[model samples]
Target chain A: MSTPIYNRVALIGLGLIAGSMAWAMKRGGVAGEIVGYARSEETRDTVRKLGFCDRVEDSAAAACEGADLVVLAVPVGAMGGVAQEIAPVLADGCTVTDVGSVKRDVIDHVAPHLPDNVHFVPAHPLAGTEHSGPNAGFAELFDNKWTIIVPVPGADRDAVARLTSFWQALGANTDEMDPEHHDLVLAVTSHTPHLIAYTMVGVADDLGRVTDSEVIKYSAAGFRDFTRIAASDPTMWRDVFLTNKDATLEILGRFTEELFALQRAIRTGDGDHLFDYFTRTRAIRRGIIEAGQDTDAPDFGRAQKK
Target chain B: MSTPIYNRVALIGLGLIAGSMAWAMKRGGVAGEIVGYARSEETRDTVRKLGFCDRVEDSAAAACEGADLVVLAVPVGAMGGVAQEIAPVLADGCTVTDVGSVKRDVIDHVAPHLPDNVHFVPAHPLAGTEHSGPNAGFAELFDNKWTIIVPVPGADRDAVARLTSFWQALGANTDEMDPEHHDLVLAVTSHTPHLIAYTMVGVADDLGRVTDSEVIKYSAAGFRDFTRIAASDPTMWRDVFLTNKDATLEILGRFTEELFALQRAIRTGDGDHLFDYFTRTRAIRRGIIEAGQDTDAPDFGRAQKK
Candidate 1:
């Protein structure tokens, strides 16, 4: 085990990412004193019981006192509130970061509230599952995942490097991008895809044409993949779209246009056109698999009823 | 090993499902011989070299001549044509079944063409991977997966029973459903979801505003899951959309309406509505996992670096 990376670390949420961060820090010995603070007493109690932190506090300010690192792990919409509450009590030279999906809004919302001596660096750990809450966290969840760090102009170098080291200790490969670029990239890669999944699942449910039982029974066909995606925590996703509206809508527009073309190909029976369109996308999957981003399993292999 | 279920079994398509079927059959000794046929010489050559079949024939008709079980393993679009070409040569009293995804259209197209003496059963082994071609198959692909059989009216009961038993021998649990219901169920469970996935991926591809690398590299965010579904065989999926039009279109319409509501909630910053909508969907995922349908791993754990 290595020495803790920070003298004191503050986690401002008790959900999946926050809990997982605490677990990773403890497992890696990447921080000296692990402190967790949630807005709820129940969550504080759970964090204490779950042993996610050496100390659990009900207020963000309480957790931030004397802390060298603070991670705001709440929904995107709550980052502003969290940053404000902790700014007053933040230890001198402390660095602030977040695990929000979209980066621009988080930077804009949280940066203004931080004290001059403290640094605010926006980050998105391209990780997590549909499951949420402290119990949903596991120490290994961050292993080999991408961690995008979006540094605002004039952000302190020492602050950035410290945060980078913290994530590196969690077994993440780190990349840096402009906060706006991060949002746009995620809008296409994460936000729109999830929205489309949610929309399609909702559509299937509302159709009322196929009995719900049939959908559930035959989910292995393909719909189950979307459900897996659609099953993601709604609050996190809802916050994503809300904060990254411009980018989300932009991707949505492009998606609708392409969908129309494919729809035309299907309607007109243009087999070659449809085939080529489908064929091009395969390279990306191959790349992902090669990059070790996904398993090559057919969508729902294990659950397939024999 | 179990006694061979058939003296010879001929698989007509050497794609992932068919290749897997051959591997499973050969490994289990469910058939003394597994012959394969493909229109493309390249595919036939690959199948032969892969050693999944005893012989790879150039023509579907030539492949089924002595084969006791003729499995039509082609795309749904080619099922009718393949059936027409092979029907005359299939051994009299031979049990004929298909591993097509859509049942009603397949039943409508293939049943009439098959000779009266040939027992026709429309069966779909709900097993597959996004990967296609002979090399992509594995012997264990169908293990624990459901195989749905939609037999024609007054079809040979013994033949249907035997076919179901054959699928069972290959490690699939078999059930029978009405063809129309099968189509409807698949539309909700598979077809519509695939369409949406294709649409979303296409949309990301068309983003003149966002670079392709951004979409692909950052895909760990959630977009990669849709791409996996989108990267499926275009010819197969196009035919799926065409054959399952009504159900798919109906589901698409419902999906669009729900999307509109979601858009409204995002525009209005109705966090409550977004939270509720997002939260309600969570139950379905829990139900699926509880029913042993999906892994609790987040989005199949796609976000992990690999």
Candidate 2:
């Protein structure tokens, strides 16, 4: 194992991302001592039993004490409160970062509370499963995934580089993006897609004519993928939509406009239009496969039910 | 192996479903001989090389001659033509079925063309991957998957029973539904979902602000699943939308209405509404897993990229 990059690393919330980060850090030896804190006592107990963290602190402040790196791993809505809670105990010159899905709102909520002595860098690791909670994490979650680091303007260059190296050592490829751009990119790639999925699943569930069993039974046709996406942590997704409102709404608007056009084409029996639009989207799937963002395996490599 | 369900099986249009049925038939000894035909010479040649079929015929009629079971495994729009072409050659008392996505449309297009001597049972195996073509088929594709059998009014009981047994031997659970209900259920579960995915992927591709590389590199977050759904066969999807116009459009209307409500929630900062909606959708996913329609495995058990 490589030498520890941070003498002490504190994770303020014990959810999927943080738990995975702790396991990854332990696997990589990227942190000398990993301290974890969760708002729920049950979560803390679960983490302690899991043994991925070196220590489970009772409070966020206690977890942050003398830590060289502090990670805010709470919901985007809770980032500011966690930041305020842990700020006073963070060691001077320690780098503070967040794992929120939306970056701009996180910076807005988190940056003001952090002390001037600390380096605040916001990062989002664009990787997760439909599962959540403390037990949902694995060391390999972030392997070969992209972790976009959104550094505040005029931030310490050394701190940024160190955080990048830290993520790299934890098995992620790191890139720097401005917070606004990061939010917009994630709006297109993550937030809006998730909202659309949730909407579709909700629509299916609300339909009185189509029984719930029918929707669930026939889901493998296409709806199961939407169900998987919609099943992601509700609180996390709520916070995501609340915080990333502007970008998510903007992308949703575009999505609806395009959807309406396709809906019209279907109504009008415009076979050529529907065919061309569908044919163009296949190129994008090909690009995703070629970029190694997803496996080319049929059905996302899902095991056949037998 | 069990007794053969049919003496000879003719598969019209040797694509994914037909090729898979050929393999599954071979695996279970469901048919004495499997004869395949495709409109394209390339597909027939590929199926011959794949060795999934006992014989590859140049024409649909030749393939249907003397066959006790004939499957119209073409696009929804093409089903009528194939049925008409094979009607004259189909043996007396032969049972004919289809693997089309839309049931009512296939029935309207194909039923009138079939001779009274043969049974026209429309069956749709609610199983497939984004991949298509002859090479995409596997024997396990239908294992433990549901196949909805839509029998025409006055369909011969013996023929229906034999066809259901044939599907069961090919590794599918069979259920019977009327054409109209099957169309409506599939519109909610599959047709509208595919259209929405295609529209969303098209919208992402159309956005100039979000570079293609950006959308692709970060797709693992959620957009990749949309890409997979959108990447499905263009011709098949186009025909599906055109033929199942009313039901798909009805579902699309409901989808857009639900989407607008959620969009309003996001814009109005209605976190509780968003949270409740998201939470409700999670139960359907749980039902799907419990029903054995999908795996509880994280991320659908996708293999981690190293």
Candidate 3:
């Protein structure tokens, strides 16, 4: 913990990312006073009970009033509406940023509503767990994770620098990327992978060859990984697919093409192709471990619980 | 450590499963003298340096001489040839088993070559890291894991009991399933899932929108999990797909059907369908955790490396 980066920080939509940001900000002394609001009363009650913020607000507009930094941590589909509600109340010179997974969609939806006095910088933090809601927040959720900052053209440099420093203080490594590139990169890295996992898990469920009980019981083989990825927050993912349609479908089309080729190889007993393909992918996993993004311990270093 | 189950145990291939079995058996006191062999001199040297086995033999036959148990831990494609080599030398009444992912193929390929005096019991342990070769083995690999024992009809009861006890001592819970059912179950849980993960990782590598460096750098989201599965032994995986073609293709067909449906829903903006499918998958994950096959830790309990 150190000197505060912002005097007051208000978080709109107290879910996993927002709640986690609150805990991480407090842990790093990045904000003096924190206030949070969620659309659902149940979520609000949960946030209040958890005490993630110094104060809880009932509305988004109330949360943003007089705050130096206001984070729009809502679902992508809801960002425009939330931005509309907060636009009238945003303090002058307040820096507004969002934590949505999709960047261009959020910028398009949110930029029109924000007042000129407030600096709107967009960010997408590549961090989270399958868990969600208020209880899912942790002080270390953003620790050592990547946060990509996508600033609109002609944006204030000082605001961008301050937000970058704020994210760094909250324990994330920051980098700059254009909104279009960010969407394309994330579609390949996160969005499409998640959809594939969800689809595979659903396939296992529908298959009669392996009963659901057996799939669940013997998941440690490989299916368990897909299940964990597939178990992410439902509404949030739905919104991500709905918002990042072009990039996602483009990646999916490529994915299906690659999948059909591999399927053909399997059917044809082409061991050389399969072996070569499998061997190449292993190098990328090694790169992830070498880059310090992941641990090399077998089974992701997860302790085998008895 | 307790009394040895067998005076001499020979492991035919010094790969991940064989090396782990050797270390685990020694750790749990199931084998008195463990002898191992691999065709690759490099692997043999690695195993010798590691001292996983009491003696390192140059050939499968040399390793199997006078052993009470012989484990064929080679890739599924090579099981029959290895079985033929050792069949002429296997001790009378010795139990010859394998650790291949597919059970029916192993039974069909290896059973005829085995001596009539030897008992053939095919087994597939439902555990492994996405690593291979001698150095990948650890004594704790089988702890809290499931090992499915696929005993052919008319298998000697005494040999089956001894093998069960040996695996139990190696820290695994054991169960028996018919060879066909085991193939079907594993095709769903392990083989098909691995293929899908491999296909997805390959797709990411081939995509022009996302650079390989970016894919590896921001892999923590969900792509990392797929990479881990995709990084598994190429030779071993190729054999699994080739030997278990029928079951794998059956389940894969089902997987494609489900994936296409989800992809259609995404194109048409069916948020409700997406949410419901995602929610249903979450329960399967919960069931896996409850069944003790996997831990409920966020990110599969992998500690965030600093």
Candidate 4:
């Protein structure tokens, strides 16, 4: 086993990301001691039973004490509160990082609360499943996935490098981007698509003529994929939209404009327009497969699973 | 093997659906002989080499000449011409069916040209993958899926019953619906969702600031799912939008209305509204899982594939 990167590591929230990180850290032997804390007593009990972490702490501040690495894995809206609660107890020269989906707002809320001696690095891992909470995590969740690190300006270079090594050791490829760009890219790639999916599923649910049973039975056609995406954690998504408001709104605007154009083509019976648009989109799917972001297997390989 | 359901079965288009049906029929020994034809000579040549069919004919009429069952497996737009071409050659008392996505349009296009002596019972198997063409077919494609059979007024009851049994033998559950209701149901569960996915992917492709490479790289963050749906056959989707225009347009209107509300909530920083809507959509996903329409495995069991 490799030597530990951090003498001690603290995970502030015991959700899917934190649980997965703990397991991955254990798998790689990358942390000397992993201490976890969650807001709820039930989650703490569950994590303690899971035994992925070295110890479970009852308080966030207690978890951060003497830890050279502290990860804030809470929802975006709750990051600042947790940061404030643990700020005074953090060890000197420690590194504080986050796994929130939105980076700009996280920086705005978390940077001031961290002590000057500690380095604050914000990151978003572009990997997840529809499932959430402690039981949803696995050691291989981040394998071959992209984790974008958004380092703040005037940050200590050594702290950033060490944190990058930590993520790379957890089986994720690492890249750096400015917080604004990171937020904008995530809005396009994650937030907006999720919102659209939620909206479509809601529309299907609200339609009285097409009963829920029929919609559920026929969802394999295409709607089931949307439903999977729409089933993500509601509290997390609420914070995402509220925190990354401008970028998500911007992408949504572009999406609606394009949708209106396609709708008009359908109304006018312009088959060429529809065909060309669809043909162009196929190239993107090919690019995704070529880039190793997803599998080219039919139906995302779900058909083969049967 | 059990007795054949039909003495001879003719497939007019050698695409994914027909190829799969041929394989399923062979697997179940449901037909004594399977004859196939495609508009393109190259497809017919591929089918002959693949040997899924007993024979590959040069013309649709030639394939259907003495067949007891004829499946119009072409695109929705092409069904009318194929029906017209084979009108004179269809054997008396034979059953004709289709695997089109849109039923009302198929019935409108195909029924008028069919011979009165033959029964035209339109059907749609709600199963497919992003991949297309003859080589993409497998016998398991239709296993446990649903096929809705729509019979015209005064259609032969025996013919409908036989067709239903044929689909059941191919490993599908059978249901009957009026043409109009089937169109509306599919619009909610398939067509509108596909259009939205196509539109989202097109929007991402058109963004100048977000490079195609970046979009492709970060697509695992939910955008990849839309890309999969968008990668479906261009001609098939184009025909679907054109033929199911009324029902599709109606659903699209509802989708846009619901989307605007969510957009406004995001703009106004209404977290409760977003949270509630997201929570409500989750129930539909649960229903889909319980109804056996989709897998409950995380990420559609894609992680396990790796």
Estimate how well candidate 2 is docked, as a DockQ score.
Answer: 0.83
- For each candidate, give its TM-score against the true structure: 0.94, 0.99, 0.98, 0.99
Q: lDDT by residue for model 4 over B1-306, one digit each (tens)?
A: 989999999999999999999999999999999999999999999999999999999999899989999999999999999999999989999999999999998999899998789999999999999989999998988888899999999989999999999999998988999999999999999999999999889988988888888999898889999999999999999999999999999999999999999999999999999999999999999998898888898888766666
Please give the lDDT score at residue A60 for candidate 1: 79
lDDT accuracy of residue A276 in candidate 2: 97
Off by over 4 Å in 3: A304-306, B303-305
Per-residue lDDT over B1-306 for candidate 1, one digit per residue giving the tens place of the 0 to 100 score: 878989999888888888888888988889988888988899988877889899888888888998889998889999999999998898988988888888888888988898888888889887677877778888887776689999888988899888988999888878899988888778777887787777777666766767776676677777777878877888888788778777666666666678778878777877788777776666666666666555676556544424
Per-residue C-alpha lDDT of model 3 across residues A210-275, encoded as one tens digit per residue: 689989888889999999898899999999998898999988888888888888888999989999
- Is 1 or 2 the stronger prediction by lDDT? 2
Classified by CAPRI criteria, candidate 3 counts as medium
- lDDT (Cα, tens digit) per residue for candidate 4, span A1-306: 999999899999998899999999999999999999999999999999999888999999999999999999999999999999999999999999999999999999999898888889888888999988888888888888899999999888999999999999999999999999888888888999999999999999999999999999888899999999999999999999999999998999999999999999999999999999999999999999898888877787666666
lDDT at B291, model 3 = 89
Question: In terms of DockQ, which candidate is strongest?
Answer: 4
Fnat for candidate 1 (0 to 1): 0.61
Predicted chain A of model 1: TM-score relative to the true chain A?
0.97
Candidate 1 residue spans exceeding 4 A from truth: A297-306, B299-306
For model 3, residues B108-206, the per-residue Cα lDDT tens digits are 999999878889988988999998889998888888788999999998888999999889889888989998899888888889889988988898888
Q: CA lDDT, every prediction?
A: 0.80, 0.91, 0.89, 0.93
Weakest 10 consecutive residues of candidate 1 chain A by summed lDDT: A297-306
